[model samples]
Target: MNSKDLKILNLFKFDENLLISYSINLLKIIIILILIKIIISIGSSVIQRFFNKQKQSKFGFNEKKADTLSELLKSILRYVMYFIGIMWILEVLGLSIKTVIAVTSVAGVAVGLGAQNFIKDVISGFFILFEDQFAVGDYVEIDGLSGFVETVGLRVTKLRDFSGDLHIIPNGSIVRVTNKSRGNMRALVDITISYEEDIDKAINIIKDVNEKMKKEFKEIIEGPNVLGVTNFSDYGATIRVVAKTEAMKQWGVEMELRKRIKHALDENHIALPIPKRIIMNYKKGETNGN
Candidate 1:
């Protein structure tokens, strides 16, 4: 009787119903994983298309903002897909979701504390994007580092300077930003002449040249006004020339203005100041008198 009962107990323990449930759960998990992959693929494609279309529209849309939104959408989609996939997998394995969530909450708090800087960077980056501080391809000075913005990520900003130097900066550390590409830039030039030269004539020549230059270079927004007698220094009387030019055109305009002024002075016979010294010739036989 004891041997028969033991054999029956072993058969019951290896029941067919248990095998069927296990196989069904395994199939369900596999199907869920496949479904998750399909959803992720389709969702990513849709997001990419929508954003790409937005970028191409003639709505005066900002390229950087479109790129940022696209990236954020992709990141969120990936995370959500994986999270649901994992939960479904756990459910198939007969695990309690409530316990998993409790543990994840504890771990999340710890992670939040450990990743405070990352969180701050993300928050600051959002603010920067929303505030329109700067964008890709814009020349800006941030935290004393000046460069063209290469990329604007959630945590860091990438910049490429004129010298080909690349700078990676945390968003939270960027306290102040100076965007040089936003508005008109000022062009300044200073000219000097000898004290012996006629000041009135020099100013007149300068004003004449500026008038002609304004007509020549349409980039000059306002008069390259010759502010006469700006300073009377030891070297000479400093005359100032100032003009406003379009952004990124200031440098070229300034250089051209300087060249024009130099050429004008030469043509007008304006004298440049020189350091002077006096020397006395001594007789060959003369000696020092004591």
Candidate 2:
């Protein structure tokens, strides 16, 4: 071998001490990884138990709120533990913690300037949770998208619509939220009766149906009484019935009310409106034709 090649070979020679040092560091890294996983699992379980306890307490913390807090806490904990584990691993691999932090600080300044939206999303998410604007399982409309909230994470919120489509929305973009599941909702139904039928008789029939429904459906909170003749169209006169129902139960109640109203009208011999048309016939020698 030439002199230059011999010198380069000597520089990279694998000595016993160097091999031992690398194997020790590798073993330490494996141990650190295993420990991180174990700790994270245990921490997650603890967080869940804490929330479950809160849910079972009589202090007025509902299941939905408890679930939301649990998920958020677990997420935060997992990320923190992973970050710590990575920093420790780097230190074990001969990089000092202070040096690593100094380098990251310089990079973080540049990243922070470019990631304003990310910061805004995280801040907005914190406010959403703290303010109790909406929780998981709540039917809400945000930025014109209506759905049941599935998750409220630091960066994004998940919504599942009636059609089973999942929407992932960034938290910063959710400036306004309309929550429909917060209180009672109104269930409205309109029925049309023929003008020829007695309006008084139709009203009585609807009242009877409403009385029976009030007893059957406990979700109905207020009257399903007919509001008299609301409008007159070419087809018929419209009668409106409205009821207050528990949140998320309005649609079911409205459907049931319509079905029962139809049956009641049929039983009482009240005729429902049907469209009709009149036709005029012209002879061959009509005035305009002639």
- RMSD in Å for candidate 2, one decimal? 4.5
What tens digits encode model 2's per-residue C-alpha lDDT throughout 19-55? 8899999999999999999998999899889989998
**TM-scores, one per candidate:** 0.63, 0.81
Q: Kindly report which residue stretches of model 2 are placed more than 4 angstroms away from their true locations once superposed.
A: 1-38, 274-290
**Candidate 1 on 1-290: residue-level lDDT in tens?**
69999999888888877898899998999999899999989998998788788889988356766766665566568778998999989878887899789878889888986578888987998888788888777789998999988777777888899899999999988998999978888889888888988989988988988899899988888888886788887768888989888777888988888888788888989977765644544766555432
Candidate 1 to truth, TM: 0.63
- Alpha-carbon deviation at 76 in model 2, angstroms: 1.4
The worst-scoring run of ten residues by lDDT in candidate 2 lies at 281-290
What C-alpha lDDT values do all the predictions have? Answer: 0.83, 0.89
